[model samples]
Target: MTMQHPAFAKGHVAVVTGAASGIGLAAAREFARLGLCVVLADLEGDRLEAACQEVRALAAGGEADVVAIATDVSRPDQVESLERAVIQRFGRVHILMNNAGIQPGSSLFGPQANWDSVLAVNLMGVIYGTRTFGPNMMSHKDPALIINTGSKQGITTPPGDPAYNVSKAGVKAFTEALQHELRNTQGCRVTAHLLIPGFVYTALTANGRTEKPAGAWTPEQTVEFMMRSIERGDFYILCPDNDVDRATDERRIAWAAGDIIENRPPLSRWHPDHADAARDFIAKRD
Candidate 1:
């Protein structure tokens, strides 16, 4: 199948969740730069406004359009309101970026609230966004895309933050399933993509960091990579950072797969006896 261009036409509408900061904000800005009508949605009202203003300023003297909506992605009512706001403002949505997420670092047997909140936003948010906007995009004959932001932690199943990991894992699985179903649908024009980003310093990880770490990539860089992947018709938009390359990421992911394929203990990569083997596996030249 031929891949579509990354450029958003002058009147096309793009909806982005978690647009207050990080990759979501970067994508919104890039969409506006491409002359698309951009809808920025986030839980933080002030930050959302600021991001929308920045996008508008960047589009000044251009035909790009921008709107900001304060939304809690976990709440179905709020997500519905976001869709209404977008349609009321732009008449149609051509792109949907399911990027709203939160990382609550709690163990599997830890507090229930953390798991609830993380799953509600990370997993349910993507579900709601797709369910709400997917049919509209499908009815339109024009090309449309749904980008779901997942995580490397989700695919690798690391030791810490089981709640966050599970939520992202669900996103990965759901996006893949959604894409398969969409491709098989007789007249569907909507496509789904899983965006797996590597270590990037953002508000989610801003507990005490004053400067970006060496291994991290900027939100702009991540968005740039995402746009390129979309143009390439990549369903799994796995991104690498300053410290890790695609090869390293592939090895890590393969090791994770081996855990299940070989029926080892959960997260055997972090097991004391398996540490050396895991390291060797990750460092092995292909």
Candidate 2:
């Protein structure tokens, strides 16, 4: 399971939030396989321990290396404690991945709890992780990276799940600012990135389903794409799932942005009145 990837070099240390499952766990395994001492952080205690074991099994050079910390990323204190523990154990963190997220269904008129919970985890979690680990990494001369997981829903502003979309949208805005600041800071070696995943078959998107839908991409595939994008120095890693190709994604994104420029009904692409026009626009692009 050892991956000989150039994105993460040997002897480096990485801290990945939401490492208990899904894309976070998959990315953590890849980092460990590449000879980096990885720290897995997640809220699920049992799942975090099990994920650590899996990552340990993939260690290229023996000694059972890896640590699992139960952390609630929503709380600043917990995230700060996780950083302290990582530094205490591993010395320095070269990679920080704020991948913890929750997909609570909601609409414009949804309960305040749903909005609060989603924002606390998806948005503030990323903010806290960056604010805590980023400064120390910047002080070090070693090259480092911080990846925040966002969602396509945030960009397109599609129908349904408005709360989830809003939180992720905040992530997009915050990470963009973070990257800009990192690039401008003198002697800083860390860079920030936003990961926008399409329909991925993860626990968050499973919705109680036992089987994976054909339209969804597996965690492995998503991480592979992420690594490739990172190697290209991509700030926005927009991933494509099984049902959506790059071209289709581009068209959708363009149309979404065009909604403001064209002054069409909000989300008019989905509106019955604009269905024909939307299809025509896509057809012309194709």
Candidate 2 TM-score, true structure as reference: 0.95
What is the C-alpha lDDT profile of model 1 across 1-286, one tens digit per residue? Answer: 5454643666788999999899999998898878788888998668888888898876643434787888999999999998988888777888999999998579878899999999999999999999999888888767889999999989997887989988999999999999999999998878899999987889887668989998899999999999888888899999999999999999998998998888877788899878789999999996
The best candidate by lDDT is 2
Best by TM-score: 1
List TM-score per model, in order: 0.95, 0.95
lDDT of 2: 0.89
In candidate 1, stretches whose alpha carbon ends up further than 4 angstroms from where it belongs are: 1-7, 60-64
**Each prediction's RMSD to truth:** 2.0, 2.4
Worst 10 residues of 1 by lDDT: 1-10
Q: Any residue pairs clashing in model 2, and if so which? A: none
